[model samples]
Target: MGSTEDTTSTTYSDASSSPTQPLLSNPAPTYPYPYPDPPPASEPEPTQFLQISYNYGPRPIKDLPFLLLFSLFALSTFAFGIFSSVNRNPNSSSVSSFSYDSTTASCVKNATTSSTLRSPTFLPLPNSFALHSSSSSLLKSLIWTLVITLIISVPFAFSVLVLLKHYTKQIVYVSLPFFVIVPIFVNVYWFVACTVSSTCDEKFPLAYRILVLVFVFVIIGVIVWIFVVNWHRIELTVRIIGVAADALSRNLGLFGVLPALTLGLFVYFVPIVVFLVLARLNGKIVAREEDGEYYCVWKQDSWVPAYYALAIITMFWSATAMVEAQAYVISGTIARWYFSKDGSSLKRSLRSSLRNAFGPSSGTICLSGLLICVVRFVRAVVDNAREDAPGMVNLILRCCVNALLAAIDFLNKFTINFAAITGEAYCTSAKMTYELLRRNLLSAVFVETVSTRILAGIILVLSAIYAIVVCVILKAASNLGVDSYFIAVMAWVLLIVVLGYFVHVLDNVIDTVYVCYAIDKDKGEVYKQDVHEVYVHLPISRNSRSASALVARTPLVV
Candidate 1:
């Protein structure tokens, strides 16, 4: 359903150019300083690499503004943590009295009791030590503090090593420091909350809460103001998504869609099933009856570590395989759309694409999965820690793990896209994908941020409606024989899986198409596109080298 009109041949150069000559055989003319000189002909011509890297590195000077901005914000957050801690313990009274008021005590109780699989429920402080602020309890708390601190530090330290080893640019490396400081800030924040409320209820005093509300309102107002101001750009982004959806619909017909959905669901559910098996093996998933209802619960046992270890291993395998397969399918579908090929061409490409993903790209995505495993392992640690005792240490550790998880997830999205496009391994593709985003920061941010939020919201709304309809039908059909809670849980889980499947499909298409667009635009001579105008009209800064580089850079593919 895309434009079949071939405006221009996929020609690389002028009409007078020899048919045998390659498009990028000659070095591009030199630009001003800071842009590196063209590599010698013997060096395999750096233009292609530059075109790939074009999307990544900008001069350090160009990123100075962002670095300074984030640094100041991180420092401010860190300082605020310290300030709150001091206010909570002006004379060190908190150190002597590990006591809580009734309100805080009830809040903790409710939080612990009402927790479910979908959310983290608070647990009261561990009773391993005495309740009094005795020396033994204090010493145990300090040891817990150090252990949690070390656990949190491990992942960040690994990330730092990764950045140093692979990414030399200031913009790439500088972001790590900000991430590292976040856990410290979180730790301090929790320390302050525990010191003040003793039970870690995050409610501030009435006056402070009012001030916080005012600040939040001001932030919301500013966000609204910005959205209103940039309505046109947002509209254009929506239209671009519409174009992508059209392409997706045509390329991934019922036959293609089912396979993609099956692959994604299999990958996702297999781990859960394996985890369950492991749980059962450890005798953790215990069945019990309460109030005439039968239900199952997970009880951690001594073999819990074994369960986690196996879960991590399976997660790496499943994620690697899933990501590789998804990339192949998505990229294959987009290739057909980009090239305006027939259905038969898609069929032809499918086998080859899958081969590429599972064959050559296995090791690369496995590396990516290793990163995912690390994040998951850390999460498992945090979850176990919290289950043992939900205190300031676990709270801070969970927060830090969540932040790192998000960062890794974001990185993986691009890594998959890069792997799809280049058939490179995970790390190489990640570097390349990051480079592209680095080069086209404005457009990348605009498209990804706006589209993800809007598309997810739309999908979730539809999913909710669908879930409600299915639940009503199921309830009515069974004459309400089934437990309503079980029905609701199944419906929700199914909806999420279904919605997530399509969401990821759309995500891959969007990423692939944009990468194609960037590469095609850089190449300058290709079958023209109807959707380039959408990107053209988006708000990229005119004066910045980053924007100009995107504009002036040649396409990566012929």
Candidate 2:
């Protein structure tokens, strides 16, 4: 018994000491086990997934072929214009004096010296006495008009910024109601005045009068409905404008950049204008009589008309390109400012954005500009056709063309904003923008209307005030003569354009912020928490689920 007990103790001690003995006895579960360590915790089911391959550095050139094609076309056009101008005859008579002879019952060329006839040529040359006498005062008036517009617009833009930043709610509240009420009041007043006037009653048919009244009522109803629908969204619009104002205030350098771009555009236009003038001189001189005076007229070549069209189209394209480039710069810089990490500096953001806009993205800009130019050209044609033939069909055609132009404009607004942020090609940016808008339809519609109307109202008021101030100043201080009306009108239009630029910057900012917010929502992450919070109040849509499902199907790339 003592030996057995000692052996048992030794065996138990050996069993305890041997590490593999218990595993062999128990025999660990094989491949058919019901569970296995919960699959190593499953990576926490990521809350935010990648959507776009967002690039922070310079992106590869997109739509390069389009860029090349546009460059070739522009260069060819310029070369042809230069050639035409250079080959034009400087001594060609624009017009020849003709006298109507009663004896022959026909027109006859007067025996006049070329030099005398040329002095009163009808081409309105810069050195022509008639134009030369008025050109100085006209030029002086124009110079003063531009100077006044700049002076007013610069300060007005800053004031607008201040108002947008600090008084956005007030501006929106005031402008919204004013716009809604004023239009209705004007329409109603006109309708009433016309109804009360016997002359109007006699001139217009009863059916037309009834139609006008119905239209007025319908417009009032529609306006009220819109106002009511968007009333709740005023806060969101103000927030958006405020955000844009903040961005603009931070990047005040944009103001300087905008003027520089305008100057560059003006410089570009000078040569084109010269080309147009020179091209006009390429035609034959003909004698014509107007208002009892025999004068020489420049009969433009057949090709001259076509070349004028081309040059005008080019100007339109260039203007559109410049506008888009401005938008891209604003959008890109704002995006950088929006996504920048905390405590980071963005001193070079504007420069980087400029490089991106005119560098790899220039082709995209050119393409968009071309589309706008084409649409505008088509619209102009439709307008002329409508005037030539007033009918239901032409009217309907005009409406359809106008609608298409509007659609293109709306799509471009967001697509350019998206491309600015993502550095995507135009087509890709357009597709993505469409998807985003589809997902957030209500927000987009309401915010767009509210913001656009408010800005329009601001522009109108500011322009009117500036125009009045200009007229007063011109009357008080300058001897512009009849040019006062011309100067006032020019100054008014100029102020509107300058103010429009400011509005455009803000418009792009609003769009960029909305797009960035939509992206954040899609990714389930917020780059701008404040914007997210403010926009979170936007009514949710059922499309969010489908958007999420689509995201789930897409593989996330690290």
Candidate 3:
């Protein structure tokens, strides 16, 4: 009995001694002051996305290939079989390596890791179990069959079950937006709804989508019905709703209050929230190790909290949009069709009008952005098209193209302001920064916004022109004619595109005083104060050295 008790004690001790993951309970490691939790938050509370207290620890199952290969050696231990995680099936191809040619020459197609999402597939998976497949292809195939079969039958089971239960009918309404907000969690439920859910699936397979849409039509209809029935009763409601929407969205901003547009807005804001959370969590942002030394700059940022707050704003706004948009679509139709309730025969005709509104209303926000892209697309094509060499039409087209270019530049600036704040720069990196600063410091002059834009554009155009012009001039000299003129223009056009982009990069680097400032502070961040950094002396101006001029002139493509 004493030996048995001792064995039990050892086992318990061993289990308890294992390291467990720590929770991010809103306190820093350096500050050992115990975390005083905030008061409970409720509706109208500042929005916050809570993280689950548990992490799956690190990926201990690295080099899955070896384990898979080992499974083939089951002859050694007579254990050659499949290894599967719970909720996952074991399959043959599941052990096989999967690879594909990628978009940007990366391991994953884009040569980029998922910056925000945990999954390679951004859309949440409801039914990917085991995280591994079966060793037997036939077995894997059978599992898929069962999965599909289950998906097909479950929906009907649910709809019929719910229809029979009176209490379940109202529950559907309350449960909808909850699913809307975190559909990722109850993915299996939605997946079931998608398949064999109901005959209503024929009309609207997504019962939630139909219910929401119907609800929208109903709400809008009631508002219209009230307005028409009284003929003049609630001037305040109409004015408040209409004016407030327009006022809040005077800037080219998203409107979250209305149902006509909301889902896309939710998608748009998700990245913003994700970025903030990641920045707070990222090892790079929190601290850095260099030359056997470590540095931290976490609490130095004041806007850290604002990131979370803004994400909350994005979520609440999205939820509001889903609710309000649903109300409009559901109620508007009823008002238009059934408002009078007394021989409103023409009210049936109102369906045509409502249909027109509802047609594009479902994705109006997405549609608006799409339209902008279309406009940008057209502008890109037209600008690249040949122009009359010397005519008013040419001038007009040029002006229009220039205006479009200007608008795009402005829009990009606005986008940056609205987007999650980023601390990194793309393109030439520190080299570009050094060059621009060298030019600036040497010239002892700053680039005016217009000159900056034009100067960069000129360098790129000149470089590209040089390359294309050299090529075209050779062609023209060999067969000089009207073709010569065309060749010259071609040189000029290609020249503009490449050189223009080069200068654009150069100009952009100079403008980012903030980034340069950060770099100067790098000793305090990335590198240790002790280790010498390789610094390049750069020429920063128009009248600069060969390195920068080559940067613009060497462009084969923008």
Top TM-score: which candidate number?
2
Tell me the tens digit of each residue's lDDT in model 2 across 134-181.
Answer: 788778778967986778678888998998899988877776665556
Give candidate 2's whole-model lDDT. Answer: 0.74
Model 2 root mean square deviation, Cα atoms: 14.2
Evaluated against the true structure, the overall lDDT of model 1 is: 0.51
lDDT of 3 at 134: 23
Q: Could you give candidate 3's per-residue lDDT for residues 382-436 as a string of tens digits?
A: 6666442657787788788768776544433222211101111111122333332
Candidate 2: worst 10 consecutive residues by lDDT?
Answer: 23-32
The residue-level lDDT of candidate 1 at 207 comes to 63
Off by over 4 Å in 3: 1-266, 277-300, 340-558
Off by over 4 Å in 1: 1-230, 253-308, 340-344, 379-408, 465-493, 541-558
Ranking, TM-score, top scorer first: 2, 1, 3
lDDT (10s digit) by residue, model 1, range 1-558: 112212122122232233222222344533222224645545554434444312211111222332344334334433433433333323222222222234432111112333346767777678634444454543553354335434543343334223322342332224323332433443455455555773344544546645654665566556556656866665565666665665565554533544665677566655455444434333223344569654444444554465455444554555554554566567655754575533334554555555554555545545555566567777777777877887888788788878888877777876766665556555556666665565465676677777665556444544444445555665665433334434544555555555565656676677777767666655663543566765666555333344334534444221
Query: Which candidate do you rate higher for lDDT, 1 or 2?
Result: 2
Question: Clashes in model 1: which pairs?
Answer: 55-435, 55-436, 55-439, 56-435, 364-426, 522-554, 522-555, 523-554, 523-555
lDDT of each: 0.51, 0.74, 0.34
Total residue pair clashes for candidate 2: 4
Evaluated at residue 31, the lDDT of candidate 2 is 21
Each candidate's clash count: 9, 4, 39
